[model samples]
Target chain A: MNKRILFAVIITVILCGLAQAKTTITWWQFWTDPNIKPVIEKMVTEFEQANPDIDIQLTDLTWANGHEKIVIAFGSKTGPDIVELGSDWIAEFAANNLLMDMSTQVASDSADYEGWGMATYDGKVFARPWILGTRVLFANRDLLTQAGYKENFIPLTFEQLNEATKKIQALSPSIYGWGSNAPEKHRLYKKFLPFFWSHGAKLFSDDGSMCLLASDSSIKALKVYKELHDSCGFVADQRGIEDAFLEGKIGFIISGDWLLKRIELENRKINLLSSFIPGTKLLGKSFQGGEFLAVNTASKHPREAMRFIQFITSPENQVKFCVANRSANPSSLEAQKDDYFSSSIHLQTFIRQIKFANHPPVDPDWVYIEQAIEEAVENALFRSGLVAHSLYEARKKIEKIKAQ
Target chain B: MKWSKAGALALALPWLLTFGIFWLFPIIYSFIIGFTDQQLLAADTQWVGFDNYRALLSDPDFLKSLKNTFIFVLGTIPLTTVIALGMALLIDKQFPGRGLFRSGFFLPSITSMVVIALIFTNLYQRGGYIALLSEMIGLSPPEHGFLYSGETALFSIMAMDVWMAVGYYMLIFLAGLKSIPRELYESAEINGAGKIRQFFSITLPLLKPVALFILVVNSIKSFQVFVEIFVMTKGKFETSTMVYFIYETGLTTKFEFGYASAAAYVLFVIIGVFALAQFLLFRRKQVAW
Candidate 1:
């Protein structure tokens, strides 16, 4: 009887503690490793220190499982207070009303966010950009020099890049000319989009109500991709594109600044020159992607949550997060001015070039469309030779989806 | 008196309620959702009748997924069974390092599926270790690692799955082996019957039930192969099984829950037919035994 009475008292005290505790905003992130969590936690800690009335609990998930879990959580209305969403996911979430409108918050002058306009949906920005990443050329200067190309004289146009790759291929049979991903990364769209832009094709017209992919401009983009692949004289196996680049088999590689994080570790001694993929001068474009930090609208403490997002996205914290984690070019204009740019001239070049980048449209179905386009293009270029038909078919599929 | 029916039902009540609310309700509701023509959120949804299912039957990707899923089940089951049976037979006898061998065989199963998939992706990588090994051994290594080519991607993933899952099913087979009433094997030995004959005559008849159980489970798992595809290929590699297509269509691309729900029912029917066949075949065998 005495023990039972003591146990009851202990349980009552625990319950009281739980009820009286500070409200914790549960946060979930797709980045699940020490590589990203430390800076995020430090930012959270500072916020918690500033606001003693609130607590932020963090959960981590791998990118593979991340989206599915978030969707399930959102469907069940058991979602976390905050979630880091990809640029494309914001459209679907906002369209479904699964995410809250932040335009009012921004209008209220309560939230100072730093994300690209792509994450905006119906005048409401759903995400705040954390890292600025875009696909560009990473040239192995040693390989280029051996092939008798000038060290700093990278191509300024797709035509020049082809000629340059031909020279590199002639230098060595064992080492390839250039490397890009297999069709599987669905990255063909990234490789091809700049060309599409240069050819005067818009994915959707000004109003986002029509498909321009089947247009002559898009066909011209297809021809450009075919020329690049064939003249590059190489293809990295699917998802193996990064590995191929890292193994030093290619003279030039087309991949992202995010990949540079992994690439620099391997070829620290091998001089790498990063340059913008020179367009055909009709339009200079790059496909921009980045992580974003946003306050959860459903959070019990939206004001506090907004404060945390602002603090983390601040220029000082951005530098800390970027440098500490070897992050891609920081999203903030101010953080791009840091000392890290001295050696990584390529990443700096991306920063200079990002001002000209029109982010790949934030259609909710972009990932799927990209995939179908990639497969169609790959089939047309590598397997069969139906470039025009492939573009048309892929665009038709996207149209059907958008129509629904 | 020890554990009353009322107490047992009370203990199970919470689980029943949970399944009823979260699992059963969602599944039933989804089947109903599949019949709707429009997006459930914001958009007006209406009865589409057989449109969703009809659309699935006509969709080339759905047909491709169905084919891939069947191919995956066919490829993995026999391979897993043979390997599992061999392991069960080998470990049934006491040998040096037998405990260590058993643990080593089971180790891959215990590693998180994502980790296992990553390790295999490297192993099966172009110019990776396996390629290097094959070249050294005077074998014709694939130009690129298997998954790069559409012909071998699904097979490559299926092979990795069999390697990971064989040990788990071997343990099941080992359990069945133990229950074979050792006297039967001893009698065959006394009659001077050879080991192979004894295996076919005595061991197989008894192991029929276990074999059917493993095959049915392997089919279901292989049909729903997602984690491996999710991690290694991300459904690239021609490895988009039914579950993977359902996953990407529902979540990765657009949230076309109606179409995805219909696809799930299609996969459900595929599995249902296979399960029924297994039940019929095994029921007769069980009676004969």
Candidate 2:
């Protein structure tokens, strides 16, 4: 009887040890929407259940302060095991050695993801593209009809867009024809980049060693943007523009797919349609922006973090999360072909637009470059500077940055 | 006695340690960092000496921000001081529902600045209440909203700041008024001095220290104006203040910590100079008194 008791006690001790040995992976993400938070929580729960030996701890961050918080955390060497970063932010983090290189893990299938380029630096992948957020042209169909355009008409070129905006502006003195964002740093550049891309303007040379901001195509793009602004008499930030469009005060706006999801959720009454951004030669090309998932360099449970990333970014799970959010497109190619995407014509346009989307250069100095572009745009649009002169000055500044 | 002194130090050790660790250490470290090329996320920082400061001297954006900050400070301080003093004098008198008036004036001071800024943002938007009122009064408002226009954005924010800040300063003035001996006013009245003469002779002269205090404090606050511009204009439309520029450089733009620190030190020096000048001026006046 004494021997039996001893064995039972030993067995209990081993079981408790196993339970206590569970690896906890802490993940910090910035999707704080009520609708999306639950989906993430559910996924975490599911992940924990499937891998019972791994405990997933989740922390939500607000978009406004999330990047700063992450920087502080990493700078203080107290970051979580995993983090969700904006695609634009990955370069800075990876350059600082704050992120773990996941190149080996993602190498087998990185091409299958839409925004993996943003997560790569020095030929090493540091993060996984979790979502592909691309903006398309959103038109108030009623306003378009009022402007004498045929029902379901979408502008295919800058000229067509300008003509439609002129007609729309004539419809009512209060109604604006085009909704353009203000020339704010970090924001205005993204709005204007799509125009450059559509005009076949190269921001950098083939080797990425030189800036081409003053190229003829680039100047042409700026002229077109200025023309649109002057014609439409619309000047506001993206949020203001969206609000105006929702209120039927604007006829045309270029915005993210999330706006469509918001309109649906709000059950807004306006007749709205989505199309690729108007292009000069090609169909509307846009700047590809998205979120990425990365493991912190300081994480002790790197393997567990990697497992979590893999689980969350699997094609099926990607579809599940994107369908739940209804705001972002899936990064996974297979997921993009899922029923949820195929069933909606609006979402289909976004998928097609994503094919032509290009990301900003993956340089750690991208923030400075973005500021330079914004300043140039602001000078051209608001200040008393010629577009060519502004672009030239911006190019010189960008060249200095690149040289550094 | 030495034992007692040691005991007192022991009792204060927690606060001393906290101050040293959280405040003094960061201030010193940041001063050191200001001499380096310390991007927040960069793995390596280089000691660049005075390069950041030298660069700032030639930076057009920094110069513009400095100018805007000065404008904000100059525009808001005297207005806030005078208005607050007036309000304090009015409410200091014996009257019905004086307490109610005090609370009403103090309400905005205690309210969250973020909420107030958001409300003001809407009011300054195109076709919002303020724009509508301006049009109704036959004044031509900016077509794209006050906040959107470079000419009107900073001034609009300045007006809001003055409105938001005057109430708090008024409370300070009220405190100063309460401390004054009623006998002086009564004696002046007995001398056949009118109310204006009593105010100019007794009230203004007696409130010198308090007025100086308000001026110094309000100037410091105005110089550091950030949240209003952040929430409303996002530092666009030429409304960026020095503090906003520091914040954007340090956190938002490129995480150029060293550059931001240099800018911050410049602002700190400016504020320190102003404070010293105010102190000297107040001391000279006190001597005259």
Candidate 3:
């Protein structure tokens, strides 16, 4: 009887031990795509199999409210162990000391990711770059052909683009020449930055102290934007521009790679083509932006979070995630050489444009500065305000924000 | 056993505690925060003591938002009240398909605001249904879209709001109409009074309280409009209402908690003053009548 009791007690102890051995890592991510969720779930399952003692608890956040949720979670000191942050959000979270310093973990291959600049703050790596994205010019080939353009013709210079837009406009009264984004605060800067960069304009000084929006280059860029608006007119927003292009109502548009994937999924046959943005003297550049994975400073299991980040950012995994999304480029330089990217002409153009892609300044106060730039662009384009004067006003506003 | 004070207190304790914790504490805390310089991401806060409020007074964006909100309120309330009253009158009569008409009108109010805003956004596009209809009717539509043009964007949103809100207010008016004595209309008709005269003499006077209630409620709602602006134009094209500005300041852009709190308090005061003024105006009119 005593031997039987001992055996039962030992079995109970072993069961409790097994239950207590596993540690749960709460992961909050913002990938809302139904297709991407299964991919991430499979990855999590693989990671759990590899690390038997760790379990991942995944929570999906909506893109519309994800940033606000993260802010609130960190403010209340109840954030998850791991979070998927936008590249631009790293500086804000790091400045608040809410993100763990992943400097040592990321030190080895930090140079391999082009988007590392956005994930670094104060010379310290706080996040692991996962995806890379850049926008390129997309043209409606049917509209171009209707406007008397040659087959497969792509505009490579600002002058040619301008002339092509006019021809497209003259083709039909209902059609527009260019599909451009309206002055939306969150995305307007992204739409305008390429033009600003191509005209040799700098957003800030080397040390990021002074605003250079009123510079001659910036004014020149604004004038070019104004000219485009006068000729083609701006769409209500990015989605409006995409819809206009999809409907064959617009000849030219600059958009992210997501549109290409969307066209493929919908089986849209509008003779759409992609190319680098038009430039005057140099190759057109666009915004380099993406998502990163970061460890919350308040996490109980920082090491496990770091492991998960590493697992997700591994070259093979990165390629898998990017391929599943069908829009984002892999942050891994090795993954960029994958056959999937090489086989597609659409992906090839984006890869080439990514070479000239530039990221916005990784400052905590960049949101305010971006608003100032958006306001300046809006005033120049819609209000018919003088470009130099609008830029000068924006400079004053940005200086005030910087002073604060 | 008869309830005693202590017994009542015990029963009310749960609700009172919830109210105190969830409602009262946040209000007081936010009010206190309004007097300080607090960034949500900053580690430390300083007691700035009305500096943020002072800044808002001189801030152009705040002023514009205030103006826009006032315009929205003025633009929506009267139209919504009149149309709601008209709809209530039309539906109150016994007619065939009355129930269907009533439900059809109320459908928009029952539908999700986000969905309605999105649908309206599409309709306001350059070649969307509204624009196409306008062009067919020999009216020149805006070159871009209704939402793309600064001149018409706010008005377009106001029109949609009125359409969406009239139904709910019409239901309220219907309730008010139901409470009135039908015999008064019968007596007036027997005295040779026309339908218009009876409506003006009996219906309008009796519905005074309901009208006041609708006016005050609609005004407050119009001033607090945010979701439509958020989903439709995102406060672009001069559609930045006061609430949208506060949302942008507090949540979206800089997370300037202190300044946003100050702005919010200012909006609260404006709403309170308006409500009080409306009550006084209507009460006096009622007493005189």
Candidate 4:
């Protein structure tokens, strides 16, 4: 009887020890949408099942307040092991040295994912890109045809777009040509920069020491944008503009992939078309932004966190996530060729635009620089018709930001 | 009834603790941080006494925000005070469904500002009801509607603020009106005073205290306008008020805590000055009356 009791005690001790051996890694993610939340949960559950020695704890975040929460968490040193960061926010955190250096860990697999420019800081990778997307010109083919254009009208050049919008505006007193963004900071820049870039306007010079916004190309681009705003543009916030488009009130709206999901969910029956942004020469360079995964410096379980990042960002898992998300594409190069993304025409347009899209300059001062660009756009749209003057002021502001 | 000092201290401890932790500490800490170069996420902070204040004095954005805040305060206060007073007078009359009218007027004040701002944003959109009404009246609205136009964005928000806030102040004026002695109006009527004359001589004078209180409170509230701008225009189209500027600098765009704190202190001073001036002006007018 004594020998049997001792054996039971030994087994209990071993079981307790084995349970304690499993490492728990906390992941803070921003996939709160009903459709995608389950996919994330399933993936995490599968990951834990596959790796018996690991446990995953997931926390949800919203796009509206996630950045502030993450900043406060890091400031207080209570951040989660793994965090999902917006592509633009990575540079700011990495510059502050708040992110763990994943250079050695991700070095081998870095080339597999796209948008590394946003995740790398000072020649070192700090985060892994997970999902990539870009803005596309969402048009109403019926509206174009009603305005006496071809049934499948898609503007190939800036002049064509301008004329198309004018013709569409002439269709009725209520109908509008374009859905232009109002002077909202952090957002208006995305709308204006595409026009500027398509005209070959580089934000900074080749050496990256001086502002190039005052160049001729930039002024020309601003003029095009100003004309759009003046002619038949239905100026409003992003949601308002998209709603107008969904209601078939506007001719064309430069919007993001999320609109596709919105259309599907709302079950809007309209003659819809998605195409590349109209450009001056080649196709316009739309804004590329995405989500990235990183291990916080405050994380106690860095190894486990890195492992989880790898598991979630694997090509197969990324494709599954993209399929669930319905709008965003997988960052994985291999996953980009998946049938799910290729099967949808709307996703195909976004994929092509993503290839041509340009991520804003990856710098610590990008937040401030983008504000300056936004102000310039606002000045051109509302304050004055002198696009050159607006560009000049923006260049001066950018110079000051760089100096600081 | 007398109480022991320890007992009293124990009773007050919860309030005192919360006050110190949430209010007093942040106030003092933010004031101190105003003189330093503290980034929200940066590990290190350095003292730069007077630099932030000096920079703000020359900052165009800061100046514009200050100007906008002042315009908001000045533009809304008189209009809101008169409209609320007029509303209170109408509601105070012995009329049918007076209680229903009072509740109807007070409903908007109780509603969330964010909800109202969002509703107003839609109402001010191009081809929205406002634009349609403008067309109906043959007074052509701006091409891009109200909120989207630089000329009308701030004014549109100001109009909404007044409409939402008038109800609360009207209730206050109603309370003030009820408190006035009925005997005084009886005496005025007996003296052969006309209704208009009695109102100006009796009601206006008696309502002085409430007016002063509302003016000071409204000035402070209007000067700190943020939610409407944040929701409607996002400080765009020259609608960046002082509070919105500080929020953008410290929390949203730049995360320059020190600069935002300095801007906040400046706003604090401005509000203090305005409040004091209103107090003095009201006191002198009371003496004249």
Candidate 5:
């Protein structure tokens, strides 16, 4: 009896140790959307289930906090085993040497991953493209109708939008014809980026030498932006876009699909429609504002981490991510063709916009420049009360940054 | 023989070492970086000498932010001092519900500034209550509260800060007021001094130390105002302050540690000069008695 009990005790100890044996992976992310959280949690669970030897912990932080937190973490050499980086963050993080080159891991089978090139730096891949969605004009058709604009009056060009806005303002029933956030960097930059690019303006000069903000095309783009603000009634704060649209007071908003679930949740009787915003000088230009999954250079289990990223980016799993979160599919050639995504009519507009995204200027200076430019632009508008001064001032500020 | 000094030093060693390694090194290192062309990821940093300082001297944004910081500090400190003293005097009374009122006053200061800024943002929105109230009163209320107006945005933030801080500062004043001997006031009454005269002669004179202490602390904190502008207008609407400028310069873009470090050192010097001037002026008054 004593011998048997000893053997059982030894067996139990071994089993317990096996249960505890796992490579713990730390992932930091910020997904506040109610739909997004569960989808991600499910993905994490499935990844864990498949690899019982690998344990993964997920943390959810807000967007603004996440930006600061990730930067601090990387600077301190204690970020995460993997992190979800916003598309805008690529330039900043890539510039800092915080991200690892994923090239070696995927070089053997690089074709398996699609658009992973988005995270490339100096010809080396760092992160896998996670999701793809673009900025679009959200037209509340009911609001348009109330404002005496036709249902099809969603403008096909910047000129058309202005014209439509003027018409709506004339017969408006407390409903403005158009609205866009002037002070928002992420939103405005993305919306204006395409216009600036298509209008033969490079936001940054070739070889990334100067801000080129004084370039004539950029000035024209700024003028167009000012016109949007002056012609379309701009709500001072962001909530004006979401609230006024819900109340059917705003005809159009330059926003993304991030608002879709909220609109559905509110259950407002207004007709919410999404479409590609017409370009000022070219085919509709949009920005892909999505997160990327990059493995930590400090990760103890790089092979396993890389494999996880690969598995997740697979067409099979990406569908899981997008469908569960109600987000656009990641920029995967395979994922784009998935019947589940292609058949979804509501998602088509976002999907179609994927091609037009002017790959963001990949420079280490973007995060700081973004903040400086945003502040400069807003001050020029609200403080100096002049667009030319604001853009020029913004250009000068960016120039100082670039020269550094 | 000097065990007390040794003991104190021993106890302080932990904090001293912590501050030395963490704060001192960074401060000095950043100052050195200020003299060079500092870039985080780049290995090369050519020495730039005083050029960064020279450029900063002429930078409008830097000057604007500095000006904004001073305006915010000036706008809040006096009002906070007087209002806090008034509240402290009221709370020192044995009046009914005094405890509740004290707690209520301290409530906003206890709440996070981020939450307050967020709530304030909503309040300042168009057709929001604050805006509506201004309109109803026939005021040319900035349609976006004070945040949208170039003329009033900075002051508006200062006003919110003062409102948030008065309660906290009041508690400090209340403590100082309580510590004062009641016998002194009684003697003043016996001497036939009026309430106003008694206040001027005793209360104001006695509260000098506390007032000076509050002024120094408030000035230092207000000088470093970043989050309010960062959150409210993101340093937009003419509300950008010195610290926010430092943040944008240093950590945010290209990590221009050199330029940002220069800006920071300038800020330190400005604060030091102000504090020193105040000390010299106040010390000459010889009011310790």
Candidate 6:
């Protein structure tokens, strides 16, 4: 009886000591919407349950002020162990050495994920890709049918799409053909660069020392865009354009998966059809954007933080998260092949388009470089026969930025 | 009652601490940052002396923003002041539903600027209400609507600013009108002055101080135009103001803290000069009167 009691007391003491050794890691994430926050919470709970020695403290951030908050947190050296960063933001932080070098950690598993190019700096991976998304063309079937086209006809080429849009627009004075982007910063380039890429234009030289925006292919792309803008396109910011498309006043709009989910949830009466972005010969390439997870350099528990990231970014967990997000897709190829995407035609179209999508150049200066590209597009759109001049000016500006 | 030095310092401690921490600290720190190449996330900050200031003088974007801010200040202040004066004059007299008119006119002023700007954004969209009205009136609106065109974007924002700001300034003018001792107007009437003559001589002279206040305050506010542009256009279509430029530089696109701080200091000096000029001009006018 004495030996048994002593054994029981030792077991209790060891359990208590193990409980006291639990490590708590703080994670700041941007999935705060009612429908999505629960998925994250559930994942964290599962992670904690599976690894009883580590606890996660989750903080919610809004899209509007999240960037500012992250910057301030890092500035004060109080950054969370794990933080979610937009794809475009990873380069800037990595360039500043604010993120931990994760190339060795993720080397063996890097081939399993997409969007590694965006998270890499100096050929080193700094963040892990989480969710990936691409854009597709949303067409109004009724508008096409009303304009004497077949009910389910899809435009596989730019010329055909433009012609059909013009005819649809001619049906009524209130109707518009293509929903083009206005000169809104951070948005117009996203709409224009696909065409630039479709025409085989490279944004920068192979050495990354010079901008190639003034190339013949780029000029041709701009000319094509201007022709579309003048023929039947209506200009507005992204929100206005989406609204018009939903209201049945626009024939076609190139938008992301969010619009597909929006139409499915809110207004199902509209006969919507999705298709790939039309190219000259083949389908045009779309822009790839995504969210990534990074470990802060100042983190006290880098191992726990990376383990949590890997746990949350596993194929099953990613598929679950994207299913709840309703618009985004998993960055893992295995998750992309899941039954959910294969079953839904609209989601399938986005998945297929991701195969042909291209990410922007991975550079620390891309933020300023994108602004220059946006200004060039806007300048070209505002004036006729100035596409070349605008591109030339943009090249000069980018060179100046690089010099600075 | 007499108080000890310790008691006095204790009473002033809270406000002094707040001022030192929030206002004075940032002002001085930003001033120092303006002289160096201080990037937000970069570890190394080097003193560049007057390079930032020199670059601002030649930067086309800064020059464009300066010009736009000036145009905004010049275009809106006079119009807002005159319209507020007119509305105040009309409502100062006993009229039906005077209280209702006052509240209705002041509603936009009290409403959140972001909400107002968003409402205006939809109103300014293509085929929106404003476009429909333009079409109905047999006028050709810009093909892309008001906010999309470079020629009309700033003007559209300025028009909205005037509409929202008129009510507040009108309230101030009403207070000034009320404080003018009505007997002065009666005396002018007794001297055979008509209503318009009395307004030009007695009311205008008495309201000079209020007018000066409105002009200075409106100039400062207009020069720092950012929220409307940020919400409605995001500094596109030539609508970027000085503050907006600084914000985009330091916070949004690039974290060029040094350049943005330099731009902000220039704006501060410009505002100071303008306010001083206004004070001097009003003093001269007051002496002449």
TM-score of each: 0.79, 0.93, 0.92, 0.95, 0.84, 0.95
Candidate 4 contains a number of clashing pairs equal to: 0
lDDT of each: 0.76, 0.89, 0.88, 0.89, 0.75, 0.89
Error (Å) of candidate 3 at residue A313 is 1.1
lDDT of 1 by residue, A1-404 (tens): 99999999999999999876887787787655567677788788988888776788898967766777777777667778777887767776777776756666555432333355767877777776767676677777887888787766878887877777778878766677777556655456677777677667788888988887788888887787776676664655534556655666677776776666776555445577888767775325777777776555456677666666667777788888877666656777677778875567666777776766667776666766777677767666655558888888888888887886
Ten-residue stretch with the least lDDT total in model 1 chain B: B36-45
Q: Measured against the native two-chain assembly using Cα atoms, what DockQ does each of the candidate structures obtain, in the order listed? A: 0.21, 0.60, 0.57, 0.71, 0.33, 0.63
Better of 5 and 6 by TM-score: 6
Model 1's CAPRI class is incorrect
| Position A322, candidate 3: lDDT | 75
Backbone clash total for model 1 is 1
Which residue pairs show collisions in model 2? none
Where does model 5 sit among the CAPRI classes? Answer: acceptable
lDDT tens digits, residue span A52-140, model 4: 89999999999788888898788778888899998888888899889999999998987788888888898889999989878889889
What TM-score would candidate 1 get against the native? 0.79
lDDT of 5 by residue, A1-404 (tens): 99999999999999999888999888888776776678778778888998888888888778656776776677667889888888777766766666787878777756744555467777888887877777767877765676576666657787877777766666654657667564764555665566666566776766777777767877776677666666656555565677777777777777766676566667767687777767764466776666788887777888888877776677777887777666765666677777766665557777777666666666676765666556645654455446566667778778887775
Tens digit per residue, CA lDDT, model 4, B76-184 = 9999999999999999999889999999999999999999998998898777899899899998887787976778989999999999999999999999999888888
B1-289, model 1: which lDDT tens digit per residue? 5989999999999999999999999999899989975443334578888899999989988888888888989888999999999999999999899999998998888899999888888887667787789889997665556666676778878888999999999999999999888888888999999999999998888999999999899888888899998877777656778998888777655467888999999889989999899888888856233
Residues B201-259, candidate 6, lDDT per residue (tens digit)?
Answer: 88888899999999999999998899999998888888888999999888876578998
- Measured on C-alpha atoms, candidate 3 has an lDDT of 0.88
lDDT of 6: 0.89
**Which model, 2 or 6, shows the larger DockQ?**
6
Using lDDT as the measure, name the better of candidate 3 and candidate 5. Answer: 3
* Model 3 CA deviation exceeding 4 Å by range: A1-20, B87-104, B174-202, B287-289
Docking class of 2: medium
| Candidate 3 docking class | medium
TM-score of the first chain in candidate 5 relative to the native first chain = 0.88
Which is superior by DockQ, 4 or 6?
Answer: 4
